[model samples]
Target chain A: MPEAPRTGELAPELSLPDLQGRATSIRDLRGRPVLVTFLRHAG
Target chain B: MKVRDRWDRWEEIGAAAVFVVFDDPDLIRRTMLTDLDVGALPFDVLVDRSRGTYTRWGLTRASWSTIWLDPNVYKTYARLLRSGARLRSAGTDVLQLGGDFVLGPDGRVVLSRPQQRDDRPPVGELLRAARGSVEGGG
Candidate 1:
């Protein structure tokens, strides 16, 4: 299993589509603090 | 995850929160968002249909016992029920463990946590961590 990135490590590049299908990437959010949460199943 | 008006506080603190889910976006929007009466979230909620993000974050399948047999999950459901929230039918991926992370302005992780059972930290606590990470510069 790939170990999660630890504190002080660069976050893995996360580029995905939003609900509207627009591509979004964590790399774009650099220079700003962000809280990323992975949710299981909403249904 | 009753964000509603509380997200303004997150924005005020100069921190953004993004929700990453490995599911169909429309299904998630209809069933979950509407049920919670939450509309037009101020933050980005990315869809990870391939589970690639989960994999990168080292989140894997959770054990059946860790979910169904966990008393805390039931207790949390009961509490939500008392608060008038309806129970969602079987989750799409009960085995897929979830997680939380705080990334600093420099794009470095300041905190990394994998969810266990029903133990995700409250939004308030998350905001504080995010704020601290930014202010402390990782």
Candidate 2:
């Protein structure tokens, strides 16, 4: 298991494909606050 | 879609949300159009096909205790059902857990919410967390 981010720690980077197959990254969304939610599945 | 309801609030705080899913692009695309009724979602939905991000972020699978023994899962399901969420066949790893995280402008973790079971992070609570982290006025 990788280290879980604590409340004050730096978040891990995320760069992945969107539905359109465009690469999106957390860094690309810099300068603004971000809300990242992981969904279990498409249930 | 609670987030959809409070989308203006998210805009007010100049923040955006990213939804990470384990499902493939095709499945998510279909679900977005058919089930979600949104031809285009307001937020970005990133695909985590390899689940590398999941493992790196310390999210794990649900155990027997977390799934079967926990009453909250049933409650959550009931809540979703009450909210018009249907019981559909899961397309990905059903055992894997989900999580929520809020980050400040500096990219530091503000709120890391690792789900204990089937419980999901409420949109209101997440909005509050983002306001606290971003606008300095929760």
Candidate 3:
């Protein structure tokens, strides 16, 4: 039931693994605009 | 089709595109490699095994009725069928909802849209919001 971050608000820090299994975080890409999409499943 | 089509635009803007999925990296990698032939995507695909990201983003599970009764779902299924894609077992959580978000350079959210059905917030809308965020120095 957590609420999504609203516009003009800081996005929640995200730490997840890439396809190659390397750990990646949203905070690391701070200098550029990012489009993040959440998918229901891989299929 | 949308993200791939606008790949160049995203590159021109120096914006990063990331897809977060509630499944294993291996599964996603296989799907992208086999199901899609759009070459390499100019974005990173991340794995959210714990669903923590979804929770923080307020994405919830869709009801059974919503999944089956939604016209968008049927349209998507038909489209996939026409494309030679067969319906397969749900490899992951079928009810898990998804969403799109645009984050500015300053790490602030500019657009947050939680999908209400199988289809929503067209790619054009997302791209426009992203472009606006960059132009407005969000």
**TM-score of predicted chain A against the true chain A, for each candidate:** 0.89, 0.88, 0.84
- Candidate 3, A1-43: lDDT as tens digits: 7887788889988888877778889888897889999888666
Model 3 segments beyond 4 Å from truth?
A: B35-41
Q: What is the C-alpha lDDT profile of model 3 across B83-113, one tens digit per residue?
A: 9987765647888889999998899998998
Worst 10 residues of 1 chain B by lDDT: B32-41
Residues A1-43 of candidate 2 have per-residue lDDT tens digits of: 7866888888898988887788999998887889988888776
Of candidate 3 chain B, the 10-residue stretch with the lowest lDDT total is B32-41
Candidate 3 chain A, poorest ten consecutive residues by summed lDDT: A13-22
TM-scores, chain B, all models: 0.87, 0.83, 0.87
How close to the true structure is residue B128 of candidate 2, measured as C-alpha lDDT? 83
Better of 2 and 3 by TM-score: 3
Candidate 1 chain A least-lDDT 10 residues: A34-43
Better of 2 and 3 by DockQ: 2
Q: Order the numbered candidates by DockQ, best leading.
A: 2, 1, 3
Q: Report fnat for all candidates as fractions from 0 to 1.
A: 0.92, 0.89, 0.88
Candidate 1 docks at the CAPRI level of high
